[model samples]
Target: MTVRAAQRQVVTERLAGHLLASGLSRTSVRQLAAAAGISDRMLLYYFRDKAEALGEAMGHVAAQLGGRLEAALPAGRRMPPERLLAEAARIATEPEVRPFMALWMEVIAAAARGEAPYAGIASEVTT
Candidate 1:
């Protein structure tokens, strides 16, 4: 990867952790930059806009949750959909996964409000 791409990925990972830990309430540009240990201008330099940055970070968060779920509930089972869902629910409620669930609810709330990026992002992540 290019140096710029590597740096952006690092920032995106940091932003993912920040979003999970802090939720949407503390996600100002300055706050995100602070979490990533960069200037606000540098955050913008790595991403096209706040929406793009947030979308990427949220995608990272989703990937993380997916990894955890996959590890907990491996695929290739022939269980019924209801059973599968029950297992997923049990796994999702674990302490380590709760932050991602909280962030997901926040995103859904934002989407319900017809907020920019979030509506689109939520749809993308759900599917």
Candidate 2:
């Protein structure tokens, strides 16, 4: 990836981590950018705006969770439905996953309310 792309990835990951730890409603992009040692202008430049940044961050979180799920799936094993359900339940109940779920739900709700940028992310998630 180009340096700028790498930087945006890092920023997105940091923002995801922050949102996961603090919950979505409480986070400010400016505060998160400062905490990540990035300039507000750089954050805007990378993401276009706070809403887009938040959507990108949510996408990052979703990709990470999907990776984890794929990795945790049994390989060449004939798992029973109950076992598969249990595994899914375990993943869903993980503490680390909780924040991402919260953020996703909040973003979707915001999108429903006509929140800009978030609508795109919510649509992405739904698709």
Candidate 3:
């Protein structure tokens, strides 16, 4: 990857973890910069805008959650409903899952407010 892409990926991963743990809101540029261990200017250097940065973070979190679900699935057949429910319950109560749940809810709320950036991200990651 290009150095800029690598840096942005690193920041995005860190920022994703932070958002998942803390929940999303009107998280300021300064707050995201703090979570990313960089100045706001540098954060902007990596991301064109707050919405894009937030979208990238959401995508990363979704990828992780999806990876876990995929790993738990059977290779050649659909999972049974009971087993899927059990897995869903198991996942739901995980401490780590709570923040992502909050983040997703925030995204949904944002989309409900008619924010195109969030709606686009909601489609990208939730699908």
Instruction: Pick the lDDT winner.
Output: 1
Ranking by lDDT: 1, 3, 2
Q: Put down candidate 3 lDDT per residue, 1-127, tens digits, no spaces.
A: 9999999999999989888877775468899999999999999999998888988988899988788767766457567889889888888778867777778888899888987688898988968
**Candidate 1 vs candidate 2: which has greater TM-score?**
1
1-127: candidate 1 lDDT, tens digit per residue: 9999999999999999999999999888899999999999999999988888999999999999999988877877578889989998898898999999999999999999998879988998898
**Per-model RMSD to reference:** 1.1, 2.4, 1.9
The residue-by-residue lDDT of candidate 2 on 32-112, one tens digit each, is 787557988888889888877877777778888778778888468779999999988898888867776777778878888
Between prediction 1 and prediction 3, which has the larger TM-score? 1
Candidate 3 shows a clash count of 0
Judging by lDDT, tell me the better candidate of 2 and 3. 3
Runs of candidate 3 exceeding 4 Å displacement: none
lDDT of candidate 3 at residue 67, scale 0 to 100: 80
Best by TM-score: 1
- Pairs in steric clash, model 1: none
Off by over 4 Å in 2: 74-82
